[model samples]
Target: MQHLDLDFVRQQFPMFQTELGQKIGFLDNAGGSYVAGAVIDRLTDFYTNYKVQPYGANPISNRAGEAMELGRRTMAELLNVSADLITLGASSTQCFNTLSIACTPLVAKGRSAAAGEVIVSEQDHESNIGGWERLCQQQGATLKIWPVDPESGELALEDLEKLLSNKTAIVAVTHSSNIIGTINPINEIAALVHGVNAKLVVDGVSYAPHAWPNLDVLDADAYVFSTYKTYGTHLGVMVVREDFLQELAPQCHFFNMPYPNKRLDSAGPDHAAIAALAGIGDYFAALHDHHFAGKKGLPLHRKARAVAALMNQHENELCAYLLENLNDLPVRIFGRKTIEQREANIALSSPKISSKALADGLAEYDIAAKNGHFYAYRLLQAMGVADMNDGVLRISLSHYNSLEEVERCVAGLRAMLG
Candidate 1:
């Protein structure tokens, strides 16, 4: 509310001033946030100082190894989960791929023949949905689809309830709609999936940047998100429930001891980026401290709640300005009409201008916007916007964006739309 310490926060990101020769305004934070200074410093430190295989006798290797362990705990704290249950990987796709493979053993040796199916909603990104589809194909398991609402850009839980049966071994869903900006009811979805004795997996790639997740309270068997989207370096983080971790087979070696967290990570990661995620923990904790200065009793949920409240309030104002100005301009909003009803990502199609042409035009004015489906195919198809594969011109906001900038953006768009 106090304008987010503009100089201090902006200083944390050196790229903001230098990118596009200092004139570009970043409106694509939902795609990926600019890395903060703490993350950059941590990444550089990993390369120059602790760049070695961890846990070896060498002093540097031990520190590198320690850095990795510390990073795990930091990630755990960030997600409000146990450190022992966290698995780090290269990307959300890779992590989900490895996870699906690990679940193969369970489906293969199912206690009941019916316990081999996995259910997925059509609106999820290719990252989570594609891997499961391939896994189901190979395992001779049934892949069930849950319908999404076309008009509201929302998932239909009643459809999901009808699809669930004893055969459903796992249920995977996106925590948010990247294309339409709808925040799905993941907690309720998790409850329904788990009630049917199925493991609930969540794709948080779009949700995690704007929300600080509470893994223990969220009730998902496993959660996945990308560090880059969260303003950290590039890496994939998976938080698996301790009990569910036991069901996953090892990915590394046949003789590898069964550890819940280690077994699911299939590939070796870039130590620099994986370690840089530690900075995000530092960033969140610092923000919490700033928001709750002199207050120590607040737990993770409260701190996260405060931060989210500020962000939502800030982002809503931006989206309201954009939507109000864009009204009657021959543009059709891709999601709900107001940001309060959805996240602050405004995706719109223009009858007068090609989406890409408008995106480029905005770029020429030093306004950074994007035009694409954002990989939410089912949302596009349901909304009947699939023909515009480059469906909408997108402007996604974050807490750091200012009210003045929103006005500037609306002014620019009005001129461009004219």
Candidate 2:
């Protein structure tokens, strides 16, 4: 019930100060979020004190290993898992690739016609789909799709059930779509997939920013997200069920390997940035203390709930304002019509309006956003906007964006169309 202290929250992010000389209106949050001060501090501190090899006899190296340990503990708590199950990587895509490799030998050897299958949604970000798709293509495994409904941008459970069978190996989907902004019922999907003896893998890159996931709630086997999207360092974190880790094959150098966690991070690790991810957790703790007002118990969840609530409210208002302004214009707005009814993303299209031209036009008036498929190529194709090679103009928002910024964007859009 507490209101957001926009001023205080904005201060935590240095980029809000117009560091780029001009007022940079960043609506490209779906691509990557701006880093917070606490995250930056951790990155700086790590580079200063422990920029050396880890797990060595030297003091700096020992601290380097310890720093990574802190990150493991911190992210585990944030994602609600044991530290042993947590693995840090360069990006979500890379980690999933490693995961895909680790899961290879487990795929059915085709002794019978009902060979194992991996169920991937057509709506998944390329990172989620490509790794698994390529795995199926090369491994002689079958790949089944939970296709997003072309009109609604949603995948129905019944459709998924029809596609699933005892041959199911894995069911991978996004917690939320980066394009259409629809939140998948991951918990329900997991139940359905698990009934068929398959594991669930969730891509939380978009959801992590707006909600706190209780890994237990979904009963998923593997989950992944990019820390950069969570107000933290530029890193990706993956949590695999301990059972899954043990069953999977090694993915990295054998002599240098420690555990399944190590085998999964092919790039070794970015100790400094990983430590910075812990700092982001510290920042969240501070925010919880400051924003919870009178709440008690489960501080992390309280903070997560408060932040997500505020963001949802603010983003809805912004989307409403933007949609209202564009209503009479030639633009064909995509996704849900009601702002509060949708996730914090808005896409506008026109019969012949070039998304690039609209984006470039907005840039001239001091607005920033993206034009094109945005790696949500399949979603665009489903929405029938794929032909707009430039795609629809996208305005993605986070909690930090303001009502004033919304007005500025509206004005810019109006001017461009005029």
TM-score for each candidate, following the candidate numbering: 0.92, 0.92
In candidate 2, which residue pairs get closer than 3 Å at backbone N, Cα or C atoms, i.e. clash? 332-349
> In model 1, what lDDT does residue 341 have?
48
RMSD of 2: 2.3
Span of ten consecutive residues with least summed lDDT in model 2: 296-305
lDDT, residue 319, candidate 2: 70
User: Pairing residues by index, what is the TM-score of model 1?
Assistant: 0.92
**49-95 in candidate 2: lDDT tens per residue?**
88888889989899888887887778877766677787788898888
Tens digit per residue, CA lDDT, model 1, 1-418: 3435555556667776685625677888888888877788888888999898878999999989887777777787666677778788888889999999888865654334754888888778878888888888887778887777777667888899999987788899988878778888888898888888899999989887776566767888889999888788878888888788887777875545465666776777887677777787666656767766886566654666566666666677777878788775767887677666477877888777778887887776677888887877766777788565667888888777766666776766777777
**Candidate 2 similarity to native, TM-score:** 0.92
